[model samples]
Each structure stands twice: as structure tokens, then as C-alpha cells.
Target: MKITSQNKLLLPVFCSAFLLSGCWLDSDDDKAVEPVELATSANVRVVHASPDAPTVDIIIGGTPISQKLDLDYQDATAWYAIAPNTYEISVEANLPGDDANVLTFSPALVGSQTYTILAIGSVGQGTLEALVVENTLTPVTAGNVRAQIVHAAPNAPEVDVYVTAPDTLLSAEQPLATLAYKGFTGQVEVPAGDYQIRITPAGSTTVVFDSGTLALAAGSDLLISATQNVVTGSSPVSLVVATGAGSATILDKDTPAEIRAVHAVADAPAVDIIANNALTLFDGAPFKGATSYIEVAAGDYLIDVAADADNSIVVIDDAAITLTAGMRYTAIANNTLALIDLDLIIDTPRKIATAAQVRIFHASQATPNVDIYVTADGEITDVSPAFSDVPYATGALAETGYVQLPAGDYVVTVTPTGTKTEAIETGVLSLAAGEIYTAFAVDGDMEGAAPQLILLDGFVVPQAN
Candidate 1:
């Protein structure tokens, strides 16, 4: 299908290129011509715009034009050349046991033109569709830059965009363009300099998005897109600033920190974690239990552990902790109720492809400096301490850096440093490929409260292919 302009205007003519082994269609006279005599082809690229869709392969006329192409959200393929004709384009899942075509469409292409075939909308939600946009490569005026805005957010409403001087208020400015979902703006030229970009609902003064300050250089051609954000769970939508010739950057609306709470206090009762003495993060968390990581704006927070879910009875007083952006942390309630302390551990989430990462936390006040061993489930006698001389209190020897091990089921045993007798033995812990975990040595109250091993799940960092 032809890409119609927002104003319903026809596109102008541009230069053409070479054709391959397919039929050619002359748009000027509406006539089909032989492929042998035609020398013009179209410059086209495919984009994976569906946020939740799997990486896909592009097929044309039942031929696999792009194979095993794994395009995550917002990924685009390099330009390809094809003879101008009306051809059937299909998208198939790039996964095993599921080679079904997700979508198919026929679009009339013209010779010597440029087009972008975008797979938009959500997968399986019945909104999946492909959009064809013809691109104009006309050079911008000297000392000026060109840009176009694409609205690809599947769940977002129609919006109005503003590009103004840095820190300009959206309420005081007019939108440069108003666009609907999947709609795009025509290439607009602007003076190359620093400017801020904002997006809001159509005809509303409330600002829903903002790009602080961006430096658009002279002669640069940019494609700024609003898309679903898979990272930074704090925001549903984010901006991706891509150039026609270079790399792209995700302008996250807000940087967030991932944090979890752990109850490691041996003798203390279940508690609730309160932040800023007002918000209850966790309720009735039992001893040795760990909560799943939660995302929050990066900053310093006054943290406290209360005896009640309502945070009415205070146990551990306000403890100030600063969490950095894009980092993972665990706030452990350690020591005894008499001491009532907290320890913050920065957990590294980077993933290793061939092995699992394991770290040890010494939370048991009853256990002395110990040596830890990890071996195949039944081969505890064959392996040595992965970590040695780990102390009891929250100090230099209280925790160990992550150590990598082959993925499998393993038996972990803790012993007084230099001894072979196991002070505590974890029955059997399974470490999966590319996973990260923390093993906490908790109070095994021999007198009815047994000392035990607790495992806390950690984040797995994505690996580059």
C-alpha cells in the first residue's frame, strides 16, 4: 500500500536505483514492465516495532528474505534493495517449534524510492499490522538539522509534541505537531542547537513526557521515536533517539533502582519494612525470607523495620540508605533483636553465559568465621570452600564477592575455618544457567531454633550476542 502523507498529499519524485530479478511497476503510468529492461529498485528496511513480539524473520513471496533475524523491541534492519512491484510480505517467528507467520500484507512499491516497513501494534492482541512509510532523503539547508517523530507506543493515546529551548515549560508553549498512534511527522528542519523535547496528550496542558536537553548538530538527520519501555520498570513509555547514520539512545523518563528486603535477624519476629516512615514496602515478612526486588526512583530513603504491617510498632529505627540508579541492592535485617541492625549489600547482577554466580552472606550470629564448600549434590567431600574465612558479623569478612560455578545441582556446607566437619549443610541447591543467587547463613538455633541456609534470588543481566 502507498504511504499517504498526514495532510493527504502525494509524495514528490526522487532519484531511482537498480532492480533485481522481480517484476517492475511504473507508478507514473500504472503499467507493469518486464524486469530485464528495468534498472531501478527500491531502498527498503524492516523495523520490529511491536513491543512484545518475538524476534522475527521477514519473508517475501514465500521466500525467506531475512533469516533468523532476532530484532528485539524497537530494532531495525539495515536497508535492502528489491525490484519495485506489489509483493506479499510476511513475518514469521524466529523461534523453534513455532514457525507460524504472524502477519502478512501486500504493498505496492515504486522504483528508485525509499521505504520503511514497520511491524507495529502488539502481538496476539489482534492489533498487529504493518505500516509502509516512504522516506524523503532531500538534504536540509546549511546550518539546519532535520528530524521526524514516530509514535509507536501501542497503548499510548494520541499526543502533541513540543521541541523548544532547554527547560521551557510545556504549559506555555504550542505543540510543533499533533499526531495519533502509529502516525508520524513529516521531516521538519530546525536550527541545529540544544533543545528540549516534550510530549503531552492532544490539546492538554499536562506534560506526560520530556527529554531534558538534546544537542542536535548541523546536517544531522534524526528519527525520534516514542516506544514501549522494557527497561526501567518505572515508566511505561520512553523515547529512542536514533540517527539515520549512527547509533541510538533510549531517553528514559526516570532512572530507577531495584531493591529487595531480607529478614535475617535470627531471633526477631516477622516484620514490615517501611520507607520514609510512611510507605510500607513489605508486610509480615518472616525470618530468613526475602522479598522480590521492587523498582523505585533512585535517591536516599529513610528505611525502617516495624513490628506491624501498618508500621505502627517500630522495631528498627530510621536508617538512611542511598540507592544508585540501575543498580540492585538488598537490605538485610541482621544481628539479634537486642542489636536490631541492618546491612545493605550491593548485588552485582551481570550474567555469565556458561555458569552461575554465587555470593555468600554471613548472617548467623551464632556461627564463627567459616569456610564454605559447593560441590555436586553427593560429592561434598570432593570440593573445597568456594569462600574461605568468612566472618560472623557485618564486617570485612561478613560477605564474599560472587564466584562463578558450572550450572547444576550442588550441596553447600559451612564449616569452622580449616575444619572438615560441616557446621551447616544445605540439602541440595540447584543453580541454573545464567542465574545469580545469594546464600545466607541464618541462625540455626540448636535449642529448638535450628541454624539454616537461606537462598535469595538475584537479578540476571542480559548478555550481548
Candidate 2:
């Protein structure tokens, strides 16, 4: 349950007792031998590679190493200096209403060595385990950089990796390495410059992953691990490049961006969404409705929304929206008919094992400013509002990203900025673990009425009080 860390100091004592003859040696024979000193310290880094594991809190020797609700899949911690000894490391899942201890390991660390401790495999399949690889920290030759590859993706098969000049043809080159799941290659040196990385099945020429162009600078030592792509994109694996200072992600160049449309404009009739005036992206979308995510090429397009009854009555005309690769976006139509506008949000739909992420969006043009509360047991008499003076939705994720919540049931209420009289209330929300809940507050169905809630992302709220 706890790790024991200790640093023992050993000082050697030498006795220079040499006499001219053997007579003086007898006086020193009673002295005891000096104790030997062992090497004192080691270095290690922890990585969360288990594709299905929850956000984790790592504890060693009763001390928490990872902050609560912070470390998750595809994340790595900085190197830590630890004394050379055996320590118990515990990984606890941040599940709601219970203690969830996922894995525990006691590793005997050696002095002066460096290690990467990885949590891998699937948690649901009961194959979760730990892998520790000793990293080589020796400096490389001049004008070259040292790199290593680690295969941490559970879903991928044996693969052939190519690291060559940009625009190099795959068929004419030999693979730099072949790796299976959890496999790795020894550290190798390459000339520092721009290069392209591609991966394919061991015996096939079909590429499954591609890093269009990457730079390897001189004097840099890197460890790149192939991991499950849980964040976004079509590729199954993303490369996590770890350096001495920190880590970075390398997404596939072929990954497409995603967009979801939301109909939040109250008093507006059902409409059809068009892209570049050519494609009808969402047809007959009613008020308070939202469309599912759709994939498209990452580029710029002029968006238009016209009446479902007649396409000539365009609600939104020629609104330019730029979509970037490897990102997910939400386009919401809000405000009144005369002042209608678009709110483009870069969505981050993250799933962690320990907690759920709730996105509270304000699209109600009726309320200029309101106080929002997410409370346990629907009680807010003595608690401060979670978000105060929240205006109607605007650009940049509406400038309010997902809020971290421990997995459990709760209530959500909204009222005018300074008063406690609720304009809308969620009776009780049975929120689940690792789920994302989006509750958009919109104008009431009728004029001069209180605001109402529109649920999205499959989260349902009970009737308001």
C-alpha cells in the first residue's frame, strides 16, 4: 500500500598503519573493516499508455505523484530522481463513489540507471500490466541524433517503420525497424535533418500511419512510442515523442477534422445547413436540435443556413468557417432572428476513467447574464455559484471548455446573475463515470417565458422544476 524510500550514507575509513617491522601491525589488528557504499540515485518517468484506463493518480510511498484528474492516456510525466531502492508504486483510478486501485508494482531500481515505466493493455480485458524499459542516456556522435521506438499500441499488429527523406518513395526503401505490440528497437543514430515517417504492415506496402515531415535536431535524444489514438483522427496510433525535458504528440497527416452543428436559435423556424452553398450538411434541423459529428477535409468553407420550407430565406449567409486538421468543432446558431450569429467552438470531448467532463453552454438570448450552479442533491442555498455572470455563448469553445467533475449524480440550475430565483432547474442528473454531458441553455419555446435546457451528446436531463 506504500513505498519505502531511503538514502543511506556510507563513508569509508582507511587506516594507514604501517610500521617499519611487523611489530606495529599487531596494534591495528583490532580495527574493524570499513563498510562498502552503494550507488545512491536513479531516474525514472511514468507514462499512461493503457488505452481504456481512467484518469489516474499515481502514488509512491504514500505520496501522490500525479495530480487528481490530470494524467490520462497518451500523457507522460517528467523524469524523477529517486534513491536506488525498491519502491511500491500504486496506480489508483479516479472513479466516482468508490476506491479504484488498478495496479501496483514494486520495482528494484539500480543506481545511475534511467527507466520508463509504462502502463499498457486493456483494462476491460483484464490484461493491464506494467512495462519498464531502461533508457540509454549516453550522448550521440556529432551532427547526429539518437532515437528509439516503442510499440505500445495494443490494437496494431507487427509493423515496418520507415524514416527517410521527405517525399521519399516507400517501395524503394528498406524499413528502419520492424516491431510488434510492446516491442522496441535499440537506440540508433541518424543524421539530424528533416525526415518523413511512415508505417505499414510487416510484409505489405500499404501505409497505415504517416508523419508528413518532422525535424530531428542535432544533440537531441528522443523516445517515440506508438499509442492508441483516443483523442481524434482515423489512424489507430499516434506517436508520442518524449524528450529529456517533456513530450509532444505527432498526429497522422491524413487525419481529417470533425464538425457538429447545433440549432440553438429560439423563435427561428426549422432550417437546413449548407456548406459552400453546395452541400446540404444538415436538413430540417429544428430548434434545440443538434447534428451528429461529420468528417470533412480540413479547409475553409462558407456556411449558410436557409429555411426548411424555402431555401431562398437564408438565415445565415456566407459565414466563413475554417476547419483545421486533428480538431473537432461545434457550430451553434444563437441570438434572436434580427441579431442571429454563429458561435464556433473547438470541442474537446475527453473521456477519463476517474471523472466525467461536463460542458455547460449558454445559448439563451433571452437571458443577458445568469448564474449557473452544478450542485449535489440540488441544494445551492449556501454555496456560491459555480459560474457567475455567464453571458450568452460566444466564440472559442464559447470561451468555456469542459469542466472537470467527479463521476456522480447532480443537479444543474440557472438564474439571473444576482438573484436566487431559478429561471431553469434540472431536478436530478444521474451522471455516469467517464461520460461527457452537454446541457445548452436556450430561450424558452414561447415568448416572454423562462429559459429551458437542450441536451446533447446523448445526455438526458429530467423535467425542470
Best by TM-score: 2
The segments of candidate 2 whose C-alpha lies over 4 angstroms from its true place after superposition are: 1-41, 54-69, 92-101, 123-126, 309-312, 375-389, 393-400, 404-408, 417-420, 460-465
lDDT of model number 1: 0.66
Q: List lDDT for all candidates, in order.
A: 0.66, 0.72
For 319-416, candidate 1 gives per-residue lDDT tens digits of 88776554667777877777777777777654433357788878788777888887776455656787888887644227777776666788888888
Model 1, C-alpha of 465: deviation from truth (Å): 36
Pairs of residues at least 3 apart in sequence or in different chains that clash in candidate 2? 3-61, 54-353, 55-353, 94-354
Best by lDDT: 2
Each model's Cα RMSD = 14.6, 15.3
- Clash totals for all models, in order? 8, 4
State the lDDT of candidate 2 residue by residue for 1-465, as single tens digits: 011112212111111111001111111212311111223457667788887777777777667764333576777766666778889988887655565788999988887677787888887678888888885445456667678888899999999999888889998999999999989888888876677778898988788888876656665566778988875677888887766545666778777778777777788898888999998888888888788888887778899988999999997899887776667777778887777777777766556545677888777878778888889877788878989988864432232456767767789988888888899898888776567777788888888888998886638532211
